[model samples]
Target: QGKNKKVIILCSVLAVVVLAVVAYMIFKPEEKLAVSTVEVTKQTINETLDTTGTVSTASEQSFTLMNKVKVKTVNVKEGDVVKAGDVLATFDVSSLETALNEKENNYEKALAAYNKAKNSSSSASGKISSTKKQIAELEKEIETLKAKTSTTKPSSTKSDSGVKVSDDLVKRFIKIAKRFGVEYDEATARRVLTSILSAGSSTSDISGLLDNLGTIAGGSGSFDMSAFAQMSGGSSALINAEMSLVQLKAQLATLELQSNDTYLSVYKTVYENAQSEYQKALTQTNEMKKGWIASEKGLVSEVNIKVGETVETQTVVDGKDVDISSIISSISSGIDVSKMISSFFGSDKVGIKVLNYPLVADISLSKYDVLDVSVNQEVSVKSANNEIHEGRVSYVGAVATSTGSSLDLNSIMSGGGSSSTIPAQVTIEDGDKSFIVGTDVDISIITDTQENALVVPVEAIIIDGSDVYVYAYNKDKSTAVKKKVTLGISNDTYYQVLSGVSEGDVLIKNTSGLEDGAKVKLK
Candidate 1:
């Protein structure tokens, strides 16, 4: 009976245990991850940056006139395409003629002054150089005289010696004459004395003139020849003094003549100064009139002036103000680029704009992309119509520029806070023969290229601090295996796997919640 009861209990326990196992099996399930996968392939991987840019052929052509003048006739209007050297308008030169005439008048005036400054040919013809030297010496002497005058005022013209015609006496007389605005050489002074002696008929005329000659000695003090006569003691003494007076009068005449002759040199100097002034005025005016006119094969973009319109002393044209002073110095081409019309009679007042064709594609790139780009690197441009043109990098900016497209580094890289870019240009091969002018297109610059490289989707790559990894799917284990990787070049879509990942490896595309060993079901 006991053995039979134990057997029943064991059977009941076995059944309960079986029921518990079945319940647990029904409720509990194995964990798995739903993931996407990409095949690692070996192919040529091209590292490229995608960017947008405007396709432009050439810059706008401008034509303008710089000077202020009247328009005589209008030869062309806007939208008229003309060849180089074509006359588009004529100007009224009346104002220009007047200006030239004024300048010429100034020049003539200077010449007239210069001519007048010429020392009288008859007066100082042979003594021109000597006369100039003499004048300079006199100027120094006059300065010395001024210094002397500052110390003392001359009280009298009397020499240390009595009124005798000696060297000292003559010197004193000359000093006195200079004070009175008369001077003479020694030879001339002696001739004057001899002439005075010859002219005097008697002492009576000499005596008569003595009272009138009170101021003749020219110092602060007056000389009275009458006093000399009184000193002579009697009639014979008076006669002697009268004879000396005649000699003095002759010397004074000679001194007066010498002093008057020096003025011719001063006139010559004044004329020379005037001549220089006139020449400068003439040169400046003539240079301003030698205006530059524009000539090129271009269309007449716009016309600002009408026939017979007098150019304002200052006027605004094409949003720019024109002025005479500034125009004279900086306008070497003689064209104010803002305005299209020039003015001058018999001179062409029209300006023709210049334009050229551009044979290159201009693009802008982000800083990272530009770092790998260099001049002469190969580039390929694709048009909207899928037309491709091969070219090379003609230029690459060394520094970044703000004039880049709105979409930049931020668009490609998450957490990329920068949008700064660098500008680049590419010259199309075959002279743009396959492309139309002003066509918008996509440009790809080849930064790095690899052949038969293992490439995988960029999404497959994962990052942990100081560790780069990818969730590589192992077919045998039916699991995603996190494998550290070394990477090379990359583009928008894929990365060139250098190592730690191999060709034919299935890479997990969705790395969310993935770790080193995770069970994954790839669909």
Candidate 2:
């Protein structure tokens, strides 16, 4: 009976404790939840496309030697940084000086021979004077003949083959015909030229003539030269006069040559040949004396030959001729032809490779990522060593390369097949020679950016279906107020609030236990 009484008292104590706890939860003052808050403020946000790339030199140039000479000094070694106008190597001038002396002596001998021939020809002045008088008489006779023909025949200006072609129009027709690879003899030329000129410059007429000409030049078509000639309307009188004039002009040219001392041309040719030889030797000697000069600033990537080595000439011999006029013109136009001349002239080919700076990183992007990348976009590059550098997007290729499969955009997006990639490049703005080429690097391209943007932490955002809101802390009511926000571009940690939030607005950092209109206290 005592044990039962004790058990009852213990149960009564437990009931009293449970009743007290329930009363306290139901009747005590409402507890305010402790919450951490953040203030929205203006900040810069950058949306980037992270990728991998390889370090590469922006440009590479190769220099070569163009002479067979003994190298006296080697001024640069591989991996040396050099500047424009720096002498890369020197050559022994002993052999060149001897050659230059020999050239000067030959020139002097040729000049003496030319002067002697010229003096001897001066003694024939009497014969030259007679020839000049004869030429003048012939010119007068040709003029009289032309006058007589013009008076006798009013149509003397037209062709005798019934073709009416002005000399200028004939010239123009010949030019156009040449473009189509067609030509005609003297007589046939006149008729065809006259027909084309008579036809107007309308599209149909010109195109038809071109088509017919193309047929004559081995193209596909049935073109009849006789039919083309039949279209000419010219008189015979004018052609006869023109033929007579041509004969007279030919005779006059012979007389004029005689009157000007014909032997003078022969001697002049010899003298000019000597002069050309001398000039060529001089140009080569001067260049040899200068050795090899750096055309522009670059890092030397190769040094193929050592000092004291004789590089043999590889240029064309007398049997093989090369057109060097264009090469000379290239040099005159400020193009770096030091290396080009070496290759062209078959000179002793010692290549000096140069890597030009501001460095660039080569990377490839998937088809979708390429759309967001463009030239001039800001970028950040990180090397394996944790070194960071600023850069800009320098190039984005338009074409995509397949990776074992071809798929359309819709199919690729829906996971139908493998995607293609496009090549891209970034120019490191602050890059220099210190940046190693062919190294791997990490890059982030800032595809989008916003400055002075109203932003809040992503933790403060509350997303429900299509609605985006944030729990803003109300200082007046000591509660959390739900406010809708229009979002813009976002970075990793913050969202750019385009609307519904102002700078300096307080927001709940996390909405885990917070509800709209819930009482809250700053933690």
- Specify the highest-lDDT model's number: 2
Q: How high is the CA lDDT of each candidate model?
A: 0.55, 0.66
lDDT string for model 1 (1-523, tens) is 9999999999999999999999999998658899989889999888876655556544444434434566666676765655655666666554665654543554455445435434233443554455455545654654564455457653332222233244653454445445445565665554433333333333344334432242333212233222222222222223333454444543343333223433333333333433443454354344334432334444455576778777554321211122222322223355552232232111223343333223477787666677788898887777556777776788788777664346554554765444666778876653333444556577788888999899888899886788888988888987888789988999888888889977788889989998777787876
Candidate 2, superposed: residue stretches over 4 Å from native: 1-19, 27-37, 66-297, 307-351, 362-374, 396-411, 414-424, 459-465, 473-482, 509-523
| Location of the lowest summed lDDT over 10 successive residues in candidate 1 | 316-325
How many clashing pairs per prediction, in order?
A: 7, 9
Q: Candidate 1: count the clashes.
A: 7
TM-scores for the candidates: 0.39, 0.48
lDDT of 1 at 478: 77
